[model samples]
Target: MTKRIVILGGGTGGTLAANRLRRALDAEYEITVVDRDDDHVYQPGLLFVPFGLAQADDLVRSRHRQLHDGIAYLGSGVDRVDTEADRVHLADGGVLDYDVLIIATGARLVPEETDGLTGPGWMTKAFSFYDLEGATALARTLEEFDGGRLVVNVVDMPIKCPVAPLEFCFLADWYFQERGIRDQVRLTYVTPLDGAFTKPVASRTLSGMLQDKGIELVTEFNTGEVDGEAGKLISFDGREVEFDLAVVVPAHGGAECIERSWGLGDALGFVPTDEHTLQSKARDNIFVIGDAAAIPTSKAGSVTHFEGEVLTRNVARFLAGEELDASFDGHTNCFIESGFGKALLIDFNYDTEPLPGHYPSAVGLPLLAESRLNHLGKLMFAWLYWHSLLPGRDLPGVSTAMPRAGKRFETR
Candidate 1:
């Protein structure tokens, strides 16, 4: 008798898991992946798409090709997951029975959540760079604008790549400088957080950069409505920030299919996952990973990559009837692009905020510090993302556990 391992998504987590397990597990276990489309996007590249740094074709490939041999790839939307019966229902009325399941359905952007967000000014005066289409449209809008109040607003938290909005503002500074209109462009970063970033130190550092670049930092401004017709962003407290162009990071929610599954997700549709083990609250055999998991960490690709390793091992442990390992420490690292061919890297976990240090080894890439080398590393990551990350090849030095090497602690 063979065991069936079904994965619900073919994005970062699902694709990597399928390929990794295909290599580690024997031929006896049948592995099947279900996703809506065959397009595998390098999501980070979407950020560069608006700036003409990356083309659409360069960021996407066939999902089937990324998977390992003997792994079945099904291109169909998941209708529902029957946890009790250990079965996955497809949108096409087919059913897949599995001994183990990996739910990586990821997340969806909800621009419509904000009143007047998807209105007449959408894709005209207001745009987003979170999606490829939105990024492309924003590129055009950014190019056409000569000088005005350019405001970047994040409608809510838990967005994919929380640092990306800062990156966009940083790049916009450079973009305008190149066009000889830097002084004319007024850049503003509006976020619900009290600072530039989620962490205090990094927030201070990023806030400094915003100040240096002449980008106004508006903290704790909860966006309630986008008055696209009026060219103003209305906050919940009745404060309105007028803008000629708005780059809106809309509210994000879990996949709608999660709702159809019944009691599988939270009110926002995010799967209720165990923080340490990534196990679904709904069932013992089902595990959730990546953006779908309601974790305290940023919904970034690096988080998913780190989670995949721990999750794969846990899935194996679950199948072999072994004790679950609570080794996943919510470790997440991100390369903050600060323009001018310089970038900053940050490493931390759930208990730890991002600290300044060298990562992997005591001498390697400096964390929480801007360096041209880090910028090169950020560029190099696209290759690593496609070849190493999606294929599930563990890099030699990068580990799931966050290292304290080269870190300086304050004495009480």
Candidate 2:
């Protein structure tokens, strides 16, 4: 008899994990990946779409082609998971039994969760550029507007690529500058957080950049409603921020299947997992990775790549009835595009905040500051994400553990 392994997503973490496990495990293990669609999107590219730096079509590829030849791919929406029966129910009325399960279904955007967000003024005066459709629509809107108060608002926390909202503001500044209409456009960045980023040192560094760029930083503004008709963002405290064009990043939650499966996810539809082990708290045989896991880390693509490496080993260990690897240290790192052909990179983990340093090894890329090299690295990541990371090929010195080499740390 052969053991079956079923993965619930074909996104970054699931694709890498399946490919990694295919190399780690033998032919006796039947591996299958299930997803709702064949379109595998490079989500980071969506940020560049609004600025016309990247086309939405070019950033997407067939999910089936990304997977290894040996592994099976199933395209179907998930209905729910039965932990007790160890079965997965699909929206198409199919069912799959598994010896072990990997849930990597990433976060979903809930624009309608905010009052009046999807109402009359949506996609006209107000827009969201996080999705390909939204980004493409925003491009057309951006071209028509000559100048006014352009606001970028993040409705809630725990959004995928937390820095993307900031990036949009930075790029918009540059976009207007190139059109020679920047002086007429008043740019503002509004967030629920007290600073520009989650980490203190990085936040301070980024806040200064916002100041230097002449973009207003509006912190702690909890957007409760988007009065699109009135062209105002009303906060929970009843304060309002007026805008001529509104770009909002709405609240995000885990996949619907997580919520549908009882005891499988938290209130927000995110799976509860051991942060280090990536083992699902819902059951012994189920594991989690990426934005679906309720972990205190940035929901960025680099995080998924790092998590895939650690998760692949643990799943193998679990199937062999061996001790699971607990080496995942909540490590996550990403490059922040600061516009004008410059970007900044940051590396950190659960215990350490992002600090100024070179990563992977000494004399590697600089961290926590802007540079042209980092910008090149940012643009170059798309090739890496597809050809290397998704295939589970190790990138020379990059590891799941955050490196302390060449870091500038303070002594107490």
Candidate 3:
């Protein structure tokens, strides 16, 4: 009998996992990928939509087309996962039985979770850039406004990219300056964190940059309500921040299927995953990757790519009745777009925070510092993401382990 493998969600984690496993395993194993739709979005490009740096149409492509031949693709929403019997229930009333299950379904934005967020001035004065639709709508709103208070608010933590809101602020400054209205538009950034970032050093450096750019930072603010009609954001602690234009990043939770699938997810709807193994804490045959897993790391594409390598090895080992590789460190790296044709790079893992110096080695790209070369690297990633990453090809010099050779760690 052929051993069946079922993977959920055809996003970055799922696509790469399915393709990687197909290459490693022989014809004996059957791999199937399921998703809600055929559209595979390049999530990073959503940020560029508002500024017309990129088009939303160009960022999306067919999901099944990205998969390797011989793998199956089912285009339908997941109803639930019946893990007790090792079966998956699809929304179209189809059932798939599997020997091993991989959950790569990423987080979903919950704009409705916030009071008055989707009401009143939604898409007119208040908007979001996290999605393609929202980003496209925000583009129009930004183009018309010449003078007013522009507020970039993160409704909660664990957003897609923690640095995106800051990038919006930085870009907005540049946008307004180029339009010759920098002095007229008041810019501010609001977040629940006490600092600009989770990492201390980066946060301080970013906070200084925000000050230099004349953008106000409001920290420790838990938003309770968005009174768009009143053009204000009301915090749970009763603090109100007024705004003429609100670009908000709402709270994110796991897929809706998780809520329907009993005993499959945590209270927050994310799968409880081992930080080092990428295996589900719930079951031996079930594994998780990317934003779907409630791990202590940034939920970015880079994390998913790194996890794919280790996850494929462990899954093969599990099927062979051999020891699994528990060597997946929480390796994460991101390019922070600082606007004005410049960007900053940061690298860190479970044991280390992002530090100053060069990445990979002393000769590589500068870490935690803005440069034009870093911006070019960010622009070049779109090409790499489509051709190399989706096809499960290795990126030369970029490894799963976070290199510590060139980092400047402070004396403790």
Q: Which scores greater on lDDT, model 1 or model 3?
A: 3
lDDT of 3 by residue, 173-247 (tens): 999998999999999999999989988888988999999999999999999999999999999999999999999
> What TM-score does candidate 2 reach?
0.99
lDDT string, candidate 1, 156-225, tens digits? 9889999999999998998899899999989999999999998887888899999999999999999999
What's the true lDDT of residue 142 in model 1?
79
Query: Which candidate number maximizes lDDT?
Result: 3
> How high is the lDDT of residue 146 in model 3?
87
RMSD for each of the candidates: 1.2, 1.0, 0.8
**TM-score against native, each model:** 0.98, 0.99, 0.99
Off by over 4 Å in 3: none
Q: Model 2 segments beyond 4 Å from truth?
A: none
Error of 3 at 321 (Å): 0.8
